[model samples]
Target chain A: MIVAERKPLDEIEAMLASAERVLVVGCGTCVAVCMAGGEKEVELLASELRMRAQASGQRRRIDQVTLTRQCDREYLDALAAYVEEYDVLLSTACGAGVQLLAERFDGKLILPALNTRFIGTAEGPGVWSQRCLACGQCLLHLTGGVCPVTRCPKNLLNGPCGGTNHGKCEVNPENDCAWTLIYRRLEKLGRLDLLDAIQPPKDYRPMTKPARLVHPAFQTESAPPTK
Target chain B: MKDSIACLGTETEGTGSGAFEPKVVAFCCTYCAYTAADLAGAMRLEYPPNVRVVQVLCSGKVEAEWLLRAFEEGADAVYVAGCALGDCHFLEGNRQALRTVAYAKRLLAEVGLEPERLEFFHIPASAGTLFAQRAREMTDRARRLGPSPLRSKQAVESRKLVLPPDPHPPLPPAQLGRRIRESEEL
Candidate 1:
């Protein structure tokens, strides 16, 4: 899932310094699961803003709303009814969700409240570790299940580079060497021979910026005329 | 004092002549702190009435939003009173509440509010005296801090203009007890 963390309160407050009526929009999806932006987080933020405004003797109106998923047009449409009620919409969704919301609202101000971190998985309670870089390649069959693109600082394809210090990355001693983990997993699976095959340089073409993909069935104007 | 600043949705107690009386919201775990409050009452202990005890199944059930709500709703101070460490009825519920309180304090600080206004207290069910002491401690701290800056002039004016509905209407205990007994007998 896409991981995100809320921007600092001061930064968010500064974003709304000129705006009197602010609507905080939350996404009940990936960011929600990560505890960055959810219904509860939205409420907490709204409450904080309201209190802060009142405390500072500033008369500001703050409200909160959570959409099922901000990236989808259907969910974004729900805001159209009351979109005019606020001067600004502060979105607490991932970058895609925030951008889509802005696009859907067109002409309205939509500011992000969270820093989209990475495509990652939960490591433990309140801890998440990046697992995928979405490099548009799958080399997991070659190297255990870990992706060197994300876990490795240098993104080395076949690496136990000079920076591998006793199974730990020299860049950060706390991080386990990605290649070391791959080797041990392969060794345990009795597939050490797989490591002998030299892997080529990664192709970055598919990962070009602003990548868009349409399903093969939807690529053409007409769908596959009813099965 | 009441003339100068009206109540802002918070139940203010002992509105002593012109002196500030802090309103505190205490989330009390039923297994420990809530029962301790009852014991304090039975013992006729003298404790400040500033605290409004909200009984929860466990302190762990108190979410960060709830703590934030207390402040937003005009609580001058707020606290979560749970079982002593390792003495929680649900094993680690108190520990969870501790972490939650710490997180809430950070949020309070982030919002530019004094984190000292929020606290976590560990009081076993047997510690009635301790519960009262904690209550007094919070009350004194709130008194020292004075009223929350969040209690804006608007809240004061709104309170004067509109009277909110009674959240908990007085329940006649005699009739309530008879009704419960009748249902049980039936």
Candidate 2:
């Protein structure tokens, strides 16, 4: 899922200075799981903004709304009726959600309340660590389940470079050597011989180009239907 | 002689005063503090009646604004009771609650309220008696502190005048009509 972190309160406040009526919209999907933006968080932010406005002697009306998924047009349509009630929208969704709101709202102002972080998962409770770079390729089969592109400081495809010592990366001793992990996993699987096979330098063109995936099940027929 | 006159005035004031009955909001974790409060009631152990308990799935669910809202809604004191550190039912829920409480304290202080009015206590589900004791202790401390200054007359008088609610009916249908017309032009 896409990970995000909330922007500072002061920065968010600054964006809505002219907005007398503000709508704080939260996404209940990716940002929610990451604890950046969710229904609960949306309410909390709205209350905070209300308090701040009250303290500043500004009588602002701040309303909060949460959608099942902010990136989807169907869910965003739920906000159609209430969108005009506010001068601005503070969206606590991923980057996609923020843009979706802008596109749907058209001329209405939409501001992001979160810094979109990365495609990652929770490593432990409250600890989210990046696991994929979305390099438009799948090399997990060659490197065990770990992706050196994200885990390794240098995206080494075949490595346990001399920089790896005692299963720790010399770049930062605190970090586990991704290549060491790959080596150990392969050794345990008794596929150590696979490492001996030489791999060509990765094709950067694929990583640089915009990638798209089409599910065969969802594919549309190429030919136009008869009238 | 001047001090004695003031003391006499204070003594006369004291005679008319009643016992401090604090209004407290207890945000209790369902697994521990809420259950402990129930246990205390079952055992017929009487604590202050001032506390109003709000049961949350986890203490981590308690956001900084919830505590602030408690104060805004006239709570003189707020307490968050959760499972012991490192023993949260949801792993790090209690730890997250702890961080939130700490941040809330700083925010309360910034907003001119005594941070002590907000308290956090960690106890296991088995430690029912400990929970009761802590609640009682917190209630006593709040009673001594009296009501929060945020709700005091002095604070209210000092507050700036807020503008009245928007008298102008929302931007008329004509404005929305214009917006729609402009969109079509694009």
Candidate 3:
């Protein structure tokens, strides 16, 4: 899941300074799961903003609503009727959800409340650790499931750097060396021989910006007549 | 009202009950602290009634959100009490809870809530007296801090802030930015 944290309260307040009526929208999917920009978070932030506004004597109106998923148009349609009810729309979703809101709504100031961090897995109930970078590459099968691109301080693809000490990274002694974890997993699986195959540096050509994918069925779908 | 904000204005600054009674939420593990609370009651060991005991399977199950929500719901303080160290019914439950407690303290501090408002206490099931004593200590600590500043903001005086939804749509970003800049110039 993509992890996110709400922007600082003061920054969010600055974004709202020009608006008298504000609507805080929450995304119920990834940001909600991560406890970042979800329903509970929207309430908390809205309350804080209200408190701050009251203290500053700022005549502001803050209303809050949460959508099932801000990234999807179908889910966002739930907001169509109420979208016009406020002067500013503040989204407590990840960057993608905020952009989707921007695209779906026009003539409104749609602001992002979360800073999207990275693809992570919940390590514990509330603990999340980065697990993937979405580098448009898949190398987990050979690397024992850990993504060195994200886990390693050096992003060491080949092997552990000389700075690796006693299975811990020298950069931060608290962090377990990613290569060390990979080596141990492969060794336990009896696939140590796979490590002998040297991999060339990752290909950069496919690391294209604004990447898009079209389903095979979509290609042959009937199209409207062209002029 | 959906925010469940408990107090408002002057009446809130002084809790309606006359005396300031701090509300505290205590998360107790089923095998240890929860049982200890029951034993304390059965033994007639009096503790402050303010501590509302929530029984959990393990203190380890107490997530950071639970603690934060307690504060948001107007809890003056919260504590997790579990089995004694090295004596968790589930191995290392109390130890794991301690780690979360530390993380929660920093999170509370960041949110302008008092970090001391959250704590972790460890005691064996047999130590009923210790449980009551800790409850008294937490209640006293919270009483001194007074009601949370957040409570007063919910008063009707904040009507202008939580105004009904406005019909006027916002100006475009370009125009809004110009408005702020012009206001600043004034």
Candidate 4:
């Protein structure tokens, strides 16, 4: 899922200084699960802005609303009515949701309230750690479900580097070496022999490209008659 | 004679007769505290009428700024009531609520307001009597403490600031660059 973190309050306050009517839009999907942009966050931010305005003796009118999924057009339609009521829209969604809101609103001033982080999962309650770089490839099968591309500082795909000491990464002693985790998993699965196989340099073409997806079901209807 | 009149005026002001009734804002979780308050009303339980309850989807929805704003806007007391631990409708909402409230207490103390003015309670929705009891207790405590010094009549009237919906929007690339530079220098 898309992971994100809330921008500082002072930073957000400066963004809406020019607008009188502002709308805070939150997404209830991936961003919500990560606790970045969600219904609760929207209300908290709205109240904060109101308080700041009162303290600063500034006249501002802020409103908040949340949608099921900001990236989906169907869910974004729920914001149509509320959208017209504000001069600016603050989206607490992931990067995709922020872009989607900008595209849907077109001429309106749209802003992101979160810093899009990475594709990750909750390590524990209130903690989300990066797990994937989404390099348009999966090498986890050979690495025991751990992605060195994200966990390793150098994104190494092979065995442990010299920087690894006592199963911990030298760069961050607190973090366990990804290679160590991979080795233990491989050893448990009786696939330690696979580690000896030398991996060639990965293709950079897939990582450098823009996002793309293909589905066979969707292709059939769009494909024209073949000669 | 003028001196005697001035002394009498000072005495009258010090007595604080006809002082404004303290305004208390309570953020109640809908699943528990709010329902409990509703039950209190239905049961015809008499508690202080000073509190104005704002029903939020969850106690976690209550922000620290809201509590500060309540005080800034002339609320002598602010209370947040949520479900007991492990009983939140949206699991961990109460826990987060507790943390936020604790933070607000420290912040309030730092700002010269009595930290005791802010309170947090965890009660089940079925505990209507407890809700009433807590409400009355808070009101009495606030009454004894009197109005917050920061909540003078002028301060109350001055709190009519109109906030823009998104008071702080994300800065454009240019402004962000300037901000980063400023921070680095600092």
- Scored by TM-score, the top model is 1
Candidate 3 yields a Cα-based lDDT of: 0.79
In candidate 3, chain A reaches a TM of: 0.93
* Ten-residue region with minimum lDDT total, candidate 2 chain B: B152-161
Better of 1 and 2 by TM-score: 1
Clash pairs, model 1 backbone: none
Candidate 2 lDDT tens digits, B99-155? 999988876765556899999999777776887788788888888888655332211
Residue pairs with colliding backbones in model 2 are: none
Q: Give the CA lDDT, 0 to 100, for residue A15 in model 4.
A: 80
lDDT for each candidate structure: 0.84, 0.77, 0.79, 0.77
Tell me each candidate's TM-score. Answer: 0.88, 0.69, 0.66, 0.66
Question: iRMSD per model?
Answer: 10.2, 10.9, 8.6, 9.4
Chain A: TM-score in each candidate?
Answer: 0.95, 0.90, 0.93, 0.93
What is the CA-based DockQ of model 1? 0.19
Query: How close is each model in CA RMSD to the real structure?
Result: 9.8, 12.3, 12.7, 14.4
Superposed model 1: Cα runs more than 4 Å off: A221-227, B1-16, B155-186
Of the true contacts between chains A and B, what fraction does model 1 have?
Answer: 0.32
lDDT of 1: 0.84
Deviation of model 2 at A149, angstroms: 1.2
* TM-score, structure 4 vs. true: 0.66
Question: What lDDT tens digits, residue by residue, belong to model 4 across residues B130-158?
Answer: 99888887888788888775554333122
